[model samples]
Target: MAVKTIDDTENYTIEWDEEIGAIVFTWDKYVSGATFREGCEALLDAIKRRDAAKVLTDTRGINAHDAEDQQWMQTEWMPRALDVGLEYSAVVHPDSVISEMDVESILEGMEHSGAEPLVTSDMAEAREWTAEK
Candidate 1:
């Protein structure tokens, strides 16, 4: 397995980490609604192509997200992800309080999405947890 950068931009990078057999999305700055939608679509495509079941999402750089985007993630994306073999999701807690609140809001909807979710501020811990069956 080899690591591949799926999408890299000024705001974020979405990659496939072969070591963990997961798609990792790392935020480099606050993500606008359009950027967030683009990233999510790329992530879904990567997961399907790789048959990945785990995900590690690093949101520390994001300060906020649009309410409509959050709603889309919760109502549409999360369910679609679970349908496509997403079994575990490890979210790295954001440093910004506002971003953290957004994460919490998303998690509330994910509670019943059939994927196990873990919230942590440590990347290493997130990797370890996502790697576990």
Candidate 2:
């Protein structure tokens, strides 16, 4: 399947992976406030356009995100994603301790969201999980 670039910026890249029918978001740096919002919006648009229900997010390069942005992702984006048929999300955790903590915080908030999220340090594992029906 062809890979389609949804949004590519200096800080991150969001893409459509047709092989697994998932939208992939890879962060190259820490993002907050406006940058985070823009990335989320692009991701939402990609999900809708691809009719994707699964997501593979690679956060290994990111240092961390702002608390407010994390909250927005959990409270706002998560529900909106679910409403659009999102059912699963696989996150490849960052190496930095602080970044891992931030990811954990977001995951905690996602506990009650409709989508199921799996956190891991392995990208291949994340892809495998997202590939499951």
Candidate 3:
């Protein structure tokens, strides 16, 4: 599918890749609600189109975005993702404050919602973890 961009005050992009499944926040920027929602939507779309696919959220700018938004995503969006068929094997990003969240909170949210995310530092690790074992 073609890359979709949402101008929700925050800058972000979403795309569906046959290989990666879902690619969210394909920029070197911070995370935001707009980005998270777009991602949640993209995951849902991927689930509908494809099967349970991994997600890659380029989080190079996690520090640049509002912390509350990130927390909200962790609390709210993650659960929503699980409700769908989105099984997120990993989250690609560098070490940042965002990584400090309780894995249980994130996983519980994902489990309650539909995704099972394995947060990582980059695409390589995320891909490796998500790859069918």
Please tell me which predicted candidate would have the highest lDDT against the true structure.
Answer: 2
Q: Predict model 1's lDDT versus the native.
A: 0.81
Q: What lDDT would each prediction earn against the true structure? A: 0.81, 0.82, 0.53
Tell me the spans in candidate 1 whose CA falls farther than 4 Å from its real position.
none
Error of 1 at 34 (Å): 2.3
Query: Per-residue CA lDDT of candidate 3, range 1-133, in tens?
Result: 3544432234455555545445454544544566656655654565555454566666555443455655775667665555555566465555765553432234445654444667656667665665542
Q: Against the true structure, what is each candidate's TM-score?
A: 0.87, 0.88, 0.60
Q: Please give the lDDT score at residue 29 for candidate 2.
A: 82
Error of 3 at 111 (Å): 5.5
| 2 versus 3: better lDDT goes to | 2
For residues 34-132, what per-residue lDDT tens digits would candidate 2 score against the true structure? 888888888888888888888899988876778899899878887788888778888898666676677778877555765688888888888888878
Runs off by more than 4 Å, candidate 2:
109-111
Q: Which candidate's TM-score is highest?
A: 2
Clash number for every model?
0, 0, 7
Arranged by lDDT with the best first, the candidates are 2, 1, 3
Model 1: how far is 59 from its true place, Å?
0.8
